[model samples]
Target: KLDMRRTLSEAINIQVPYNFERVMYLLSGGQNQTEAMLKMEQTQVITLSKDLHAKLQDWVSTYRVEDSEMLGTVQNLWGCHKYLSDPHTAVGVNAAQKFLHGTQRPCGAVICLATAHACKFEDAIRKALGSKFWDGTVLNDPKLMPPTAGSLQKLPEISRGTFREGEDWTQRLREVIEGRYPEATLVTPHLGTLWFSNQAMAMLLGITTAVCFAAILSKFARRSKR
Candidate 1:
């Protein structure tokens, strides 16, 4: 993978295409290694070199490469499809556009794997598209998340522990290879699309309990009145 860690600020996200172990895990029958080699042989892999990644970063915008690329992608996608894409999806958009342009033939329609809800990166969305759309209308405002919730800086405590920060270079790199900290064990070998950790379950339980308690209180109040 491209080591743009030095070039891009730590805050800026660099979403790469794929990691090898994950690919191997998928190709290797997901559990048994019987079909691994065959599956890998059949699979077509695309790699973006460090140089190419840097070039793409620069090409996306002349100034503030990291920030501009993702921001530009979010704006461009929103303009085209009336949908907001996360940084990861924006990376895919950049790659697809770059790939299609390189092709000589007429590219009919390219597929962009839009991952994650755009509201998750509300701050990024706001920075890219502004407080409102071009028409001065808000996108999913008031009742739901606005273009920016302004909470991007404050990452969830559970999510924050996933990185091995302040560790040695080798250990830090190992953390990436392992791809999970104590908090985010869901990103492990489990192939399921949906993953909810204990913390998530606890939060859900708390919310449910609060609602049930409120309902009980309301019923008791009604009974007293009757």
Candidate 2:
């Protein structure tokens, strides 16, 4: 069960082929959720450092990584970082420490946050991480919540149009078929004659459809004579 929350933004979508967990974090103390929501939206594939990967490997070897409790903690990084106290960096914290086995330095941390729409996920962030300090917390206010029916319907269609425009299957198929038939070579009488002779030879050997008719005719003639 993967929960995908879409934010409404006008940024270019970067679609990648990978599977991972999505951690939805609500930032408290009135911090702008647009940045947090954008961070969530920008996520496609998270690359782990070699050290991080090795640490994960070590943990997997020692503990059963498939344990349900372990998997849940691994999946919700952003949430875990928020609830847990951090002694360093203040603003940025690594939430994957429990599952990860390595000495911690916040090096090689290049985090990018993007969205299809920064505005859409505003409400979700406020609910999860309260907004009392971030510009008077529009989260609980009815005005801040998006109208359910209108924006949801419009987004999918817009996304589909952009996807189709970028890479069209029909056009690619057409090109493939056209390339194969470039010369427009025809099967002339010579080719037809060769095919016909081969078919005739097959028929004589009783390997064609005529064999069934011949057997039926021979049986009928014998019955008539009898």
Stretches of candidate 2 exceeding 4 Å from the true structure: 1-102, 106-109, 115-118, 129-226
Task: Give the TM-score comparing model 2 with the true structure, all chains together.
Answer: 0.19
For each candidate in the order shown, give its overall lDDT on alpha carbons: 0.51, 0.33
| Weakest ten-residue segment in model 1 by summed lDDT | 185-194
**Model 2 lDDT tens row, 1-226:** 2343322111111243212221111112232333433344576334554754665554332222222332243224325542211111111222334224545433344342221221243433333344552235333333443466235434432111111224653443344334532211112322221112223333333553477788689667755654
TM-score of each: 0.38, 0.19
lDDT over C-alpha atoms for residue 83 of model 2: 24
Off by over 4 Å in 1: 1-19, 24-66, 103-110, 132-226
Highest-scoring model, TM-score: 1
TM match of model 1 to true structure: 0.38
lDDT of 1 by residue, 32-93 (tens): 32233334445533444475456445433322235677779878887897776776678767
Look at candidate 2 and tell me the lDDT of residue 96.
35
